[model samples]
Target: MPLAEFDSSVGHSFGLEFDSVLIRQITEVSGLKMEQDVIELKQNTADGKYAIKKLPGRPKAGEVTVTRGLTEDNSFEQWIKDSRFGKMVSARRNGSIIVYDYEGMPIKRYKLINAWPKSLEISTLKAGDTSVLTEKLSITYESVEVD
Candidate 1:
């Protein structure tokens, strides 16, 4: 019998898209996670024995941080501004982070639900500095599903 070969997807080969439109020049992405809160219950048994029970409470989705090089485009900044300007309905969007294999095929996809930019930060500016300027966008979402 021949053993099957396996190849892991690279972290740099991922793409982000929002509202069916692709976002370009993404340099890094982080904070893809979900967790549940724990609830504790105390009860007294018939034999006068005390017991403590732990239960799962509500689920929490993590805030995602996306880093990209600054460009001529200002659309992403506009989206962030919408949230601050009381245009929340227009700011909320659905998005996905897709991880691709070495062959450029999608291997894993995480769907972001009702996502909106929570904060936006730009890289520090200095005179005569040649480093590429970047922007970090922190996004909050209602939930995440594997697709």
Candidate 2:
């Protein structure tokens, strides 16, 4: 199981628990941050969806997008904004950190928490460039989303 924490000083503490593949995905995804150099500090989780995004910069000209095939836009939005699992992950990012998938009309959106190890104060202070964040964490699923 993957685990992460928040410290609050020098930044927060994140206990990243990724297998092997997941570790790779996160590294690749973290690099996908629509923005350049930003830090995510919140978190949120759903049954099958997970997003950890940095809150910086607006949606550039071209960005990746996600849409629901069978899920209703309102319901899916509600799911991503769920209080328990969507606290810091709310699509609103109202108070906590969040990731917005704004592409196309209606714009399918999800929540983004700060799941990056760069936010940690331990040894992993840099983005996904440190050994502690990359070598230590592992991924369980092959399709696990990194945001």
Candidate 3:
């Protein structure tokens, strides 16, 4: 493939899909990390030396963060509020963050399953600043599927 072709696919344009809705105002999505535990074992060698062996243990998914311009809709806030009021199980949701090409086609997608809001922060307000208010949402999910 040519440089131009690869460049387009790596473009910054992307979308966040959740609750059957596409959030186009998202400015950034990050913190998709996966890690596994390593179990080490020591064994006796023929030369009277000890050798270490490593084995995979458990898998862990890190938190995912989504930042976007603050909107009038209070859906995210409501979900957090509900979760705090003994509705956490019901408030959990599944979603996906998709990276798109210059032509607006999806090139990659990170699917979030059984996700729920772990934290939400509204941008700080300044007297003379003209920047728009943005909300940062951190989510915790059971698993992540990449496609």
Candidate 4:
């Protein structure tokens, strides 16, 4: 058996309730988007779909990209430099990227094992502009776990 919250006054039941009113307002004003990254693959067989064919080659995990606003205190930059500079064998860093809900609760997390930045791109600067600088990082990892 399962339990749920019921609104007797409104004669309705709610399951997995979220702050929809607040989310709608934010979306309308700021165009906020709620999404999660999902990667999938599909394959098809040849020979009139009758002949048994060998399975396709396993797909290697591709790079995972992360982008964030650059602040005065930059930690990611340090990680990149430490991993690649002044070392006999560069050390690999393992970490996770977690996405949280509006209520400040983690909803999804990805574990990046043996990860290193493949590329980093800094935002372009222009005169008379007030946009915060951003950095883009493409990380290569041995594996990824979602939870």
Highest TM-score among the candidates is held by which one? 3
As a whole number from 0 to 100, the lDDT of residue 9 in candidate 4 is 25
Best of the two (1, 2) by TM-score: 1
Per-residue accuracy of model 1 over 49-145 as CA lDDT, tens digit each: 9999999999886699988999988877998999999898999888998887666677778898999999999999999999999999999998998
Q: Point out where model 4 deviates above 4 Å.
A: 1-59, 86-90
Please identify model 3 stretches exceeding 4 Å from their true place.
1-8
Q: Summing lDDT over every window of 10 consecutive residues in candidate 4, give the lowest-scoring window.
A: 22-31
Please give the RMSD to the true structure for each candidate, in Å.
3.2, 22.4, 2.6, 11.3
Residue pairs whose backbone atoms clash in candidate 3: none
* Residue lDDT tens for model 3, 1-147: 223554636647777788888887788888887777899988989998989999998887668888889999777788777777868777788889898766677778888888888889999999999999999989888888899
Local distance difference test scores for all models: 0.86, 0.27, 0.82, 0.50
Higher-lDDT candidate of 1 and 3? 1
Per-residue C-alpha lDDT of model 2 across residues 79-131, encoded as one tens digit per residue: 33344354643322211112222221111122233221212112335666634
Task: Name the lDDT of candidate 3.
Answer: 0.82
Can you give the TM-score per candidate against the true fold? 0.86, 0.17, 0.87, 0.58
| Cα-based lDDT at residue 136, candidate 1 | 90
What is the model-wide C-alpha lDDT for candidate 2?
A: 0.27
